[model samples]
Target: MIQSLRLATALLSGLVFGVGLALSGMLDPARVRGFLDVTGAWDPTLAFVLAGAVTASGLGTALARRLRRPVLANSFDWPTRSRIDFALILGAGLFGVGWGLSGFCPGPAVAALSGRSLPVAVFVVAMLAGMAAHGAARRVLLVR
Candidate 1:
């Protein structure tokens, strides 16, 4: 069925992404931290990863624009917002700070969890808590 196919595709995509992260040393906090340390013992490996990600993203976007709809969906779901707002700025700032401090963004952190690392588990728990708190705060603000 189409639903099963979609699930399989999603699983495969996630597997590939996780494998890529592992291979790129993105799952290693030390490597990521080294990359962020621009002034001392800088590692440039992550820069190559970032460049590859950007290139893939650019190619994907271009391909999406040429298609009428996604291969497995009814239509393409793209961002509707164009304006830069306070919420966007705040969210980005928080994300950057978190990444710089922990060297683990959401995707890489989740992928790193497979190694059963205590620190990674703690980071994931904190990340989930932050997401829940953000959702709750957003709901409260919207209710006013």
Candidate 2:
């Protein structure tokens, strides 16, 4: 019963996220591009969306940490790192560059693909290949 409830919650969360992306114009590459442009006709709407997400995620994580046990899992799975290191900074810079160039981050890229955009399809394929390479490299490094 707990697992079922968790599954339902996950599904609902995804649906809500998708709807929010759509409603916020995040599903549109043009809007994303406009925000990244930062010229005379710059759009800052995405910043507002990101601010809300960060605020909610921050609060939820803090609340979850105080819980005795995770609702569905036997234990909580949390990252130990509180410090930002070189790798983290570099990875974030690369991710931002990719988002700026493609005008579609992971979530929005997937959402855009559902609308049948060729550019999004190509971007998603390249993104998947990059993720696969990263996983392969991580596995090899961990084996040693």
| Predictions: Cα RMSD each | 0.7, 1.9
User: Which candidate has the top score in TM-score?
Assistant: 1
Which tens-of-lDDT digit does each residue in 31-136 have in candidate 2?
Answer: 8888989875689999999899899999999999899988778998788889999879988998999998878899988877778878889999999999999899
lDDT against the true structure, per candidate, is: 0.96, 0.88
In the range 37-136, model 1's lDDT, one tens digit per residue, is 9999999999999999999999999999999998889999999999999999999999988998999999999999999999999999999999999999
For candidate 1, report its TM-score.
0.98
- For all predicted structures, in order, the TM-scores are 0.98, 0.87
Q: What lDDT score goes with residue 58 in model 1?
A: 100
Deviation in Å, model 1, residue 19 alpha carbon: 0.1
Candidate whose lDDT is highest: 1
Off by over 4 Å in 2: none
Model 1: clashing residue pairs? none
